[model samples]
Target: MAATAPSQSAPLAALSSTATELDVRDMVEALGAALTDAGIDGDLRGSITLAVSEALNNVTEHGYAGRAPGEVHMVVDLLADRVLVTLSDSGHGMPGGALPPGLLPDSSGARADLPEGGFGWFLIHKLCLDLSHTRHAGRNTLRMTFPRYLAPEKS
Candidate 1:
């Protein structure tokens, strides 16, 4: 799949906060509200929230290791048929070529060890329309997109 460049347009809501679990929830709520106000449905909103949470958690846990104070930048864009959220952080980048796994393995009759970590990426991929990650100049950028879908609430 072709990757698009980072958006230059102003986000509906841009939040900069210290990488913390509480801050992640606040950012998700703020972004979800902005998208909903822009006419996105609740289902999409939930998906977007999950994707954003996963991205932010990755930055807080792996990127910064929750040690030093680092900035987590979140931007939400309302598009014609989708909502896009881009999260950027200035922290240690993932090891070169260490992309997250695409999907979770089937659990039926398969008992896999849970110690190996990669489930966040799997969940992000499953929840959002599309996700792209990039690291440049020690900054990690994650873009998550949610397609506009009419939820039961709208019907």
Candidate 2:
């Protein structure tokens, strides 16, 4: 039997998995495939993948305290003028004043400390058209968006 496409009106595709490094890679791959199928391309695909990976890694490393395994949920939505991705984790909330910086450097020169924790956040902000983070009901939700102009060209 052929696979069925998700409903257009639904506006989201979601999956939940235990917090694991391998699982995160798999999730990113799956999400990337879905986004590509939806016509997301150019730098947009790379941006989405990077942002999602960083967000998920944050959940595994900081949110879960790198000990107890928790659930990470990801949702992707296809809009007329943009693609939106939301990743949620059932782990500890972000620390006070732990938000990412507003500006990011275009070159590696701006990133002097490669071993630090700021690169992921910088990449997410630099790649996505918009990004938002929220903590609610004991979960952290990171939402990312890509504009239509950046989407992949249909074959």
Which candidate gets the maximum lDDT versus the true structure?
Answer: 2
Query: Worst ten-residue run, lDDT, model 2?
Result: 146-155
List, residue by residue over 50-149, the lDDT tens digit for candidate 2: 7788888888778889568889988888877878888888788778835667354445555574444457777777677777889888878888887755
TM-score each candidate.
Answer: 0.78, 0.78
For residues 57-84, write the lDDT of model 1, one tens digit per residue: 8888888875785889997786766777
Q: TM-score: which candidate is best?
A: 2
- Model 1 regions more than 4 Å off: 1-9, 105-118, 150-155
For every model in order, what is the number of clashing pairs?
Answer: 0, 1
Deviation (Å) of 139 in candidate 1: 0.9
